[model samples]
Target: MARFGSARFTTVQPGVKINNQPRPAPRTRAGGSLVAFAASAVVLLLLLIFILQNGQRTDVHFFGAQGQLPMGVALLLAAVFGVLLVTIQATMRRIIQLRLLTGRRRTPYTSTITRPDPADADPGADVPEGRKS
Candidate 1:
């Protein structure tokens, strides 16, 4: 019977020089932003579906004013107001922190020691005979 495939073998000589060039590094993946955008799009689509499903009209009263509006619109307005309140709170907190940081940095630091002048010394103080004027 004849062999269907022949085996190939490589022989290395003792004096033969081998090529040892280093391979280029693989590139990093840049799909993080794309993934984030897709996730946001999915969330927005779900929010749109929710709004469409709750389109029934309802009466809404705010700070003494009353008006008839769709449930979805009212809910959307409430969400917007809540987001604004949170954003304002965060901004104020950051402002206060920045003010505190800057206040701490503005104060001058001193480690100096002042010496009394010889003219301000006591008139009747005892002095060494060698240093007497």
Candidate 2:
């Protein structure tokens, strides 16, 4: 359907081309990496400062020697402990996966399923007709 006007043809004219210079050199990937690292460092510093300002102190004992520890140190130790715990859990999970892959464990549903005998069937009944029972 014609909406604006009747269909018409005109002489084609090539538009002028602007500067086609290649784009300037992009910032190095290392610069972006450094920015991300700096941002993470800032966040870590903020977290540390917040914890030091708001947290309390405690004592830790190891090999019978007890010493008072700052809240920040304790928090750091706790974080390290949590990382170790996660590492251990991941290791155990990997070990289990490897064991299963190596055939050390059987899947739960490997065996065939068996149904109970029919209600009208008998275990030791004799043949009833010419057809084999």
lDDT of 2 by residue, 52-106 (tens): 8846668888779888887777777878899999999999999999987878565
Model 1 lDDT tens row, 1-133: 4455757555854543337644444444556777788999999999898889999999999999999998988999999999999999999999999999999989686778889899999875777668868
Clashes of 1: 0
Q: Quick one: RMSD of model 2?
A: 17.5
- Model 2, CA-based lDDT: 0.79
Regions more than 4 Å wrong, model 1? 1-30, 108-133
Best by TM-score: 1
The clash number for model 2 is: 0
Q: Given candidate 1, what's the lDDT at residue 78? A: 98
For all candidates in order, the CA lDDT equals: 0.84, 0.79
* Model 1, residue 29: C-alpha shift (Å): 8.6
C-alpha RMSD by candidate, in order:
15.3, 17.5
Cα miss at 75, model 1 (Å)?
1.1
